[model samples]
Target: MGLFGILIVASILTYIFRDRLFSRNLETKDDKYNAARKERMEEMDRLLDKINSRGIDSLTPGEKRRLDELSGKK
Candidate 1:
């Protein structure tokens, strides 16, 4: 109706939607994170399968390091 009324409504809407706006960014970040994690897990699984089929010594140095990294080992 008045300038003050419109200002109040806008402020309220901003406050109400603030979390949704911020969480949309977070959701995008989380989706990316989750997809990466899934990919890493799949890689780890494939590596483990290779180890299972061929034994650990069959792995190249890079594969070993990647396995260790995936395992969270040094």
Candidate 2:
């Protein structure tokens, strides 16, 4: 094959595999972090419901701690 044909093939392969290559470089910690983030969001939703029903001042210390942690203050 000519140089142009090889370049075209190389370009196509690079394009097709670029995302996979980059994604594989992501740390496994990212998955753990995402799971933790999702869990935190769910917890926040539950806390919000509790606050809506019983008022924010009614939250237990643990719930408040979770809220503070989420807010980056803890």
Candidate 3:
């Protein structure tokens, strides 16, 4: 086989596996960010519910800090 033949085979293999490799890398970072965002939102919702059920004074300083952080106030 010539250099050109080897190059062609390599290119074909890369193309065939490209989507799988791309998706695996993409999903790793994408899913992590998505999960983090989702968890933050859920925590915020739970805090809001707690405030509604009780009162603002029901929040600890740490919970208040978290709420403020997520709201972009801190």
Candidate 4:
């Protein structure tokens, strides 16, 4: 086939296989994102429990900053 025809066929095949080629990568990224989000939620819960039990004044600097960061997003 001519170069133009070959190029067109190659692009068409790439388009057809795009999902099969990339879906796994997309799912992996989604799983990682969900895991990180869940971890953050668990951390926030732990921090809240600490606050309830001991009050805010008992939080360390890092804990205070993390709480502030999470709270500000809300």
Total clashes in model 4, counting residue pairs 3 or more apart in sequence or in different chains: 0
For model 3, residues 1-74, the per-residue Cα lDDT tens digits are 99999999999999999987667545577889999999999999999999999999999999999999999997
Compared with the true structure, what per-residue lDDT tens digits does model 4 show for residues 1-74? Answer: 89999999989998999888667554677889999889989999999999999999989999999988877853
TM-score to native of every candidate shown: 0.62, 0.53, 0.61, 0.57
Q: What does candidate 1's lDDT look like per residue over 1-74, in tens digits? A: 99999999999999999988666544577889999999999999999999999999999999999999999997
For model 2, the superposed segments whose C-alpha errors exceed 4 Å read 1-27
lDDT score of residue 16 within candidate 4? 96
Clashes of 3: 0
Clashes of each: 0, 0, 0, 0
CA lDDT of 62 in candidate 1? 100
Error of 2 at 40 (Å): 1.0
Write one digit per residue (lDDT tens) for candidate 2, span 3-66: 9999999999999999876676555888889999999899888888999999999999999999
CA shift at 4, candidate 3, in angstroms?
29
| Each prediction's whole-model lDDT (CA) | 0.93, 0.89, 0.93, 0.89
* Model 1 alpha-carbon drift over 4 Å, by segment: 1-27
Q: Which candidate comes out best when scored by TM-score?
A: 1
Instruction: Kindly report which residue pairs in candidate 1 clash with one another.
Output: none
Model 4 residue 42 CA deviation (Å) reads 0.6
